[model samples]
Target: MEPNPDREPGIPTDLLGVARIAGQSLRHIVGAVTKGAVHTATDLVDDIRSGEPISQIFDERVDLFRRAALSALGLTSTETGVPVETKVDAEDLKAMGDAMITEGWDSAQQPRELHPSFVPILHDLTPDEARILRFLAVAGPQPAIDIRTKAPFGIGSQRLADGINMIAAMAGCALPDRDHHYLGNLSRLGLVRFSTEPVADFRRYAFLEAQPPAQAAYRSVKMRAISSYRSIYLTVFGKQFCDACFVLGDYTGGGWAGDDRGDIYLGKGPRLP
Candidate 1:
């Protein structure tokens, strides 16, 4: 089955609460890819037939394809008024199609909305960065120092119980270095920030703070002064980005604390036990 050009994918309201691009724009991308690669184009069309929402198939990276299509349409960026040069190669087209499939693009609905400030960031984000954003969106506004805990155990042991450490380990980067690298990139992109003030709602995160083992661990150690720590949080832009893009709903119970490492970590969900 093919996607109906007249309808938009049915995205969850909570997920759609953030901004998104118009369904027309996505259709334009699909049309453009169809002009080139039939296989890649069919990947998106197949999802549309399966009744998947376009939101599932797109991320911030969609901005790139949108810009390219706009350029083809002879549209210019409102900010610069310069014609966007959308010269895509075969590789890029394939990648865009793959991203749509990966994002679960469905053809159940035809949407016509477009986010006003949907500009691609300076650099492409890594899976590690996406992981960090998802974590912050769930169990963030945490101390930077707590993430610095380098508890060494066997490779299979629980190496990353702390949220910050989990992000670092997943990215294959280490502390301070991870902060300076991935975190730094996220900061520049306005997706994340390092600050002393708590951005996450205290009431929303009370359960995590109230966990018995976590409290016992804090009680067992003489932690540094609160003033000495900085917390990492998703900025408003980051939150919107996550909503419009990544499949954050797949995250369960802040599953980042699980014993799984590498690729299996995010799949394990939050470690409530």
Candidate 2:
């Protein structure tokens, strides 16, 4: 198996830990670029011209940072990737404002806090629930119909609407009677916030914070699985090999056959019949 670099020595092994680092790094980069404290080519020229830090430069923009991260991870077009926007549509912007307004009043003015433990709310979810959570994580406060249709898992369009409802029920979230009921539940959990309206059935959900506990649990599970799988393969082969070795054969041209040879070689190179 590929030695999960994420779990490598000194790396932030957990997904949430990585995210926290990324967020902090991005924020720092933004601050630096904005304050003209970093001497990157783009920032230096802009700073010299403006006689101050350039507030509107690309490096200082969160959107740019998000895009860059997405691109680096090769998830820019996947369900997890953020949508590219040429311009903000007016109706969509208005809907976002309305959703925020509604959310602001409904929560008794308490801003929801996302903790890492909330990751179980997503990780322990069924495929359907995972689908909904993934959609919400990427798109943010969307209508059920929109969430269903836009889910990355290829759940059929006809089933999208009902799937979201089922996920909500499974999550034990109390659905509101209003149109935004599902969203309200998500909001209470601090998973997402409504941000935009449908220019063409377009509702936007903004990711707020990942629950720390949930993320921790997910990382734990992932690590266990990785370790377990590695152990199993090692037991079978009597040696550890990378993901590439298992799939494409080892550098020594030994895989399952090589495994047999390894056993013989380790035990006794050859035998006379």
102-208 per-residue lDDT for model 1 (tens digits): 43455542343334333345226766666666667765454443222223342233312243323454333434235457778888888887775543323323444
In model 2, where do residues sit more than 4 Å from their true spots? 1-20, 24-28, 31-36, 41-129, 134-166, 169-185, 188-273
Q: Pick the candidate with the highest lDDT.
A: 1
* Cα error, candidate 2, residue 73 (Å): 22
Worst window of 10 by summed lDDT in candidate 2:
225-234
Residue 259, model 1, lDDT:
29
Q: What are the per-residue Cα lDDT tens digits for candidate 2 across 1-273?
A: 234332224433222333443443322222222212222323433443566533333333423443343333222333433333234456534543443344335343332443223433443334433333433322222232122222234443322112122224322333412324544444454544333222121111111012232234335432221000000001111111112122322223212122133332124323423
lDDT at 94, model 1? 67
* lDDT of all predictions: 0.47, 0.30
My TM-score estimates for the predictions, one after another, are 0.35, 0.17
